[model samples]
Target: MPSLVTPVLPSGRLNASAQPALPIDGDLLLRPWLASDAAAVARVFEDPTIQHWHLRKADSEDEARAWIEQWRRGWESETACHWAVADVGDDRVLGRVSLQSIIMVGGQAEISYWTTPESRGKGVCSRAVARVARWALEEVGFHRLELGHSTANVASCRIAEKTGFALEGIRRRALLHTDGWHDMYLHARLHEV
Candidate 1:
């Protein structure tokens, strides 16, 4: 197991007063979430599979707007490094990857990702996850990275495994999704190798 780390971060308790520019994919030219991104983000959430993975039921633009706002707040607060991933070639928004739970002092963070349902099983998420993981470990100076996914979401589990995250253990009844309280696999990656 990787050594534990601790970096102070926001409690994720408040909304940010403003927006902050975030890093885009190196190979892909992703843009940060803008006020205009509400529609797109809503569309992603409307995908049954995506909603199932995220455990957020589909709703109208009004509901999606609230959630997107929270995501935006996370970015502006520096509590989470969130990005809206895109394809460099065509500037298509593929999905999003977040380096949340950042512990700057300890060089550690946790990662999460979700891709457009149409883009599933194409290695899109895997490549993007790996890219952000590498950036966090090397460029961002993080020494450890962690990820988790619903136990039933084999694809996400596979993504974590493919990205070099070690299966730490199961968090019993951890996620209350459409399936109710479901087990979750917690994975971690560290610079120690």
Candidate 2:
């Protein structure tokens, strides 16, 4: 019989300091979310797509600020990390990318993201996702990164594929949306040694 063992974190573990601003091409930058970005973040949540997929709604700037605060806590606790995807020229926030459900001992985490309505169809999410995945696998030393999206979300499917995540199959009734139970498509990318 073979013994099953999980990978453990190295000496100091992952860094939870200031989130790095990852540049994607010349148009997009993934930087840490700011307290001043509350208004913009609130606006992004106004889109029906984001509201539907994410379930909860941030109707006010205060709610959005709380969301940012939560992400900051996640970083400080070394449990998750999030970045705001911004336009390089003007520094306008375009979207968000987060590495959630982190398990340092297992060398794995789940990725989630959403783009403002204006930023859609511009490859912002795809580029940001790819950049973050690279950082997670190489710099952070995570062996695997997972992403899940509602089966009906074609855009998410395209983004996952563009970022090199292989389709791992579906989880029936995995999520509950306002409409009802929805199936989710699971995808993952593994770091090659």
Candidate 3:
């Protein structure tokens, strides 16, 4: 039986090629996570603030390495994509950006990110996210990108706005944190073409 609506993105659209490294201006790059980055990735999750917002930690370098492998699998499966935000000069890890919960049929995915403590307030997160958003919508042909964060995370809300993800509304008690249940602010951007 034929369906009435066409898939927003055809299957195999993403896994057809290897993921590419994306440049952010002259100073930053978004690249695939490498095994050597495991230690730094673990350290990033050790930050109290990161743990608070993300609700999980790497715990050990081995665990972080496992995460790196998982990211590779995500690319192969076309279910999600992750990138390490790195310094263009030396490729040192500065942060991470990802498209999660991808739905090729709907042309949608959720954006998630976090920055190293040293990179916070430096506009690294916003710049990287904006670059990824543009690539997803324009190059990858995704129709919509969504971002959601705890309402109490003012910094995250600012990032969403800066990256052109307009606030849609809030989800009541949508997520759980260490403290308790929290409301989440949802935002989204759509491809114009």
Candidate 4:
């Protein structure tokens, strides 16, 4: 039996011999970031609503380009996969769903995502997340996918609920915001595939 007081480890660590592969779904192909995506990424970050839901640097076109470069590097290094959620039939970038800060601790991977103003309430991000979650579980071999969000982000909470992530609990004052430290809701979805 386990004690309820024992805390779970963050998913950034894993023991030897428990290798988990990251998944790539060409069917849900991510187009390479373009120079044009700079403007789009900038627009996404301009949405104060979106920023309130994420932790990001001060916004600028140059920063957006730099962000894309880092995104490319992550892919090249096999560190993580980031998919630009676009208009589905066009090159216009709407937002992004990314496997950010992947921590393989204790046989799990912590996942995170975001969406732009134009794409909100349209289900683009949720569908993208579901596709990625399926791939992460069935293809990546990660035993768990962890999602964390501030309690104030109702939209993201909805996304987690819609995607079948169970609300585990809260990490009190886990993030530093513009005003002060904020509470974070920890959500988890064990590999069901």
Q: Each candidate: what lDDT?
A: 0.73, 0.89, 0.94, 0.69
Between candidates 2 and 4, name the one with more favorable TM-score: 2
Report the candidate with higher lDDT, 2 versus 4.
2
Assess candidate 3 and give its lDDT. 0.94
lDDT of 3 by residue, 69-124 (tens): 99978988989999999999988999999999999889999999999999999999
Reference-based TM-score of each model: 0.79, 0.93, 0.98, 0.78
Q: Identify the leading candidate in terms of lDDT.
A: 3
lDDT of 4 at 44: 78
Which candidate comes out best when scored by TM-score? 3
Clashes of each: 1, 0, 0, 8
> Which regions of candidate 2 deviate over 4 angstroms?
1-7
Local error of candidate 3 at 117, Å? 0.2
Lowest-sum lDDT 10-residue window in model 1 = 8-17
lDDT of 2 by residue, 1-193 (tens): 5437655544246563566778888888898889999999888888888888998888899999999999988877778889999999999999999999898778889999999998899888898999999999987789899999999999999999999999999999999999999999999999889
Give per-residue CA lDDT, model 1, range 83-109, as digits (tens): 777777766777888888766566667
Better of 1 and 2 by lDDT: 2
Model 3 lowest lDDT segment of ten: 2-11
lDDT of 2 at 48: 85
Ranking by TM-score: 3, 2, 1, 4
lDDT of 4 by residue, 1-193 (tens): 7545422333232222232232233323345566568878887777888666667753789888888888766555445556676664455676676665654433365677777676679777777788778866766566688889889888889999999889999999999887688899999888764
